[model samples]
Target: MLLDTFGRQAVDLRVSLTDRCNLRCTYCMPEEGLQWLGRSELLTDEEIVRLVSIAVTDLGVTEVRFTGGEPLLRPGLVAIVAACAELAPRPELSLTSNGIGLARIAAALKAAGLDRVNVSLDTLDPEVFRTLTRRSRHQDVLDGLAAAEAAGLTPVKLNAVLMRGVNDHEAPDLLAWCLAHGYQLRFIEQMPLDAQHGWDRSQMVTAGEILERLGTRFALTPEPSAARGAAPAERWLVDGGPASVGVIASVTRPFCRACDRTRLTADGQVRNCLFATGETDLRTALREGGSDAEIAALWRAAMWGKKAGAGIDDPEFLQPERPMSAIGG
Candidate 1:
């Protein structure tokens, strides 16, 4: 098991298929975008499957989520999902994407064993979407959501980040749209994970503010604390029951104490925490003929050294150098 000194065992694995993304969201990167990982630096399909198999069969990872600059952009995504689904314990599979090419591949992904998907969508308005993503593919995203639902990606989740003056006012409307469309909406607090390193706390929409804005149109009932478990989102029963919304307050209500996730970069580096300043390289070891036991031991050691928390509230907190895009969401 990937256990830390704080007694947190990692049961969830987030693997970055590629560091390349199609859309350049303002919160993620610059309009021109940062340098992407070279083809040689990225793990091959076999390497990714082997590492994921090790995590599931040996390291006790019960859930596997594939992320990237945009995972849908990967050519071998469907095959990768199929391979992982064939594992002995058969870990639950999912993907986090920008929803650009999802419409064309949603059915293929569902048939390939992807259980669900979480798409990044900040606004329902096409113009606002373009402004936030710096891309005019708002219609593509909407079509992707519809395709995902049609393909049976049940409880299709939407991850929305509210910038101070940009799309922060759409909190209620976004939630309302999700409720009407039978989609699960999760509002995430923008953290210091941008490539530009220009994240300002004052400009961010806090979890409290999000709830306050949402409260204007909807009556939300908080789910019991015991029901949250190690999940990042704190869910609330919308209105009365059945429908619900979630808030992933990574900056405000940090859930590091209950975190069960371990991350693998597109290049095969182990990231114990999303805000970690350092990484453990498994690619070098894998390429150097390291045995499965040796690789597993390396992963175990990496998780054992995980920090207690992200420390976003600390006076001297430093944003990660890789940014959200490189870090796989």
Candidate 2:
């Protein structure tokens, strides 16, 4: 496996298929969505599969996740998943989506060889969902969740970004809904990834606060962080049964030390860290007909230079030029 300077193995890769999204979430981007990359700039499906092949066969990556402003927005999404699935010594394939158009494509995606998915559903209330996402696709998200379950996407995880006064109070409610529906819900701490640069550390909800609120109504036993080994979410068993919950404290409790994932932007820049200010331009080399070994070497060099942490707590920390939508959440 490719290991960074800090001894963290790069085993997971997030590939952004497109920078276009269907919804403009309050925490993700401005009401008016930002400009997207040109068609020619984005990596072609064949290029994407070639890179994944190198990662799986050469770099020892075991998990391949497809992300986007919303991956479903990409027309060849099913084909992409199918390509990744064809890898020898096949890697686990998953996706993280806003769940807006998921209802229509969940079964097809599963049939295309997707193993699982993590849907971004911040609220169960229609009005609140509308306010957070700035879209009336609230029911669409719910239907998508149902569709995911029907498609046999086991453990259908729900990712909710918790802001101080916005959806922080709904932790318990969200967990209840997840438990009832057999969905594993994770509350993510709001990070400085918004396009509007409106992330205030003080206004962000912490993992401790979320646990406290949920503990009031549900008995949750904290699971060992090492159980998942570099997986972003910290796990917990809720109500002492099949129910469970997770907290991704990206701000208050950073897990950069054990981060094993690297990212590839839709436009083909390789990011070693989510908050890394710089990127290694793989697109330039790819378009110029760079060999697989050449691209793999560039990838290795980028991973080798990865920082010890994202440094969100650093006094000198600066947000990336791209927002979460552009970066692929």
Candidate 3:
């Protein structure tokens, strides 16, 4: 295993397929267009494949998750997943999407060997959903869920960012709906990753509070299926249903001690911590004709320098300068 300075293994890479997305969520990106990477500046399919091979064979990486502004928007996504599926050790490959175009492409994605998907959804109210996502189609996302289910993508994960007044009340209904749909619902604590203002604890609903709310209707319990202690969420059986609810307390309860993921931005920067001050720019070196060995060396150096934790709730912690879209949320 390729262990970092803090002895965190580089077993997972959240490779972003693209930095362009259709929606403009309240917490994700500013509505104003930001300068995107030019076509020539982005990593080629071959380069991406080579990197994945390096991560698997050279670093013993066991997971490669595809994330993005909306990963499904990437033209080369299916091909990339196919290449990842061909790895020797067969790292667990997954995708996180906004589900805007999923209904149209879910089947093709499944055929390309994507193991599972985490769909971002904030509210069940169509108008509120539109307000939250700016210009997204709630119906299309709903269809995307249906299509994913029909395509045999079992345990489709729903990622709901729990904002204080925005959609916190949607929690109970959202969990109940996912239970009926056989989907896993995970409530993420709203971190001020790229927020307009620095993250405020007042805007957050803590995991303890969430569980307290859940206990009213459902008999909540911890999960045996949690990955030792890596799972930030405490799982629960909801109201005699087969479905379960999870809470990822990233902002309120930080998961720094057991953090196991690294990120590769769309522009090819390597980020040890999402909230780190800056990234090691592998893209510039790659575009400048640096050798694969040299690029790998940089990757290794950055990994070893991983930050202690992404302090989302820390008062002194400055918000990342880069937009969430640019950094591949």
Best by TM-score: 1
Candidate 1: which pairs clash?
Answer: none
Model 2 local distance difference test score: 0.88
Q: What are the root-mean-square deviations of the candidates from the true structure over C-alphas?
A: 0.7, 1.1, 2.0
| Candidate 2 per-residue C-alpha lDDT over 242-297 given as tens digits, one digit per residue, 9 for 90 to 100 | 66788998888788888989899998999998898999999899889998889899
Please give the lDDT score at residue 3 for candidate 3. 64
lDDT by residue for model 1 (191-288), tens: 89998888888888999999999999999999999999999999999999789899999988999999999999999999999999999999999999
The clash count for each model shown is: 0, 0, 0
How many collisions between residues are there in candidate 2?
0
Q: Model 1 lDDT vs. the true structure?
A: 0.94
Poorly placed runs, candidate 2 (over 4 Å): none
User: What would the TM-scores of all predictions be?
Assistant: 0.99, 0.98, 0.93
Q: If both were scored by TM-score, which would come out higher, candidate 2 or candidate 3?
A: 2
Better of 1 and 2 by TM-score: 1
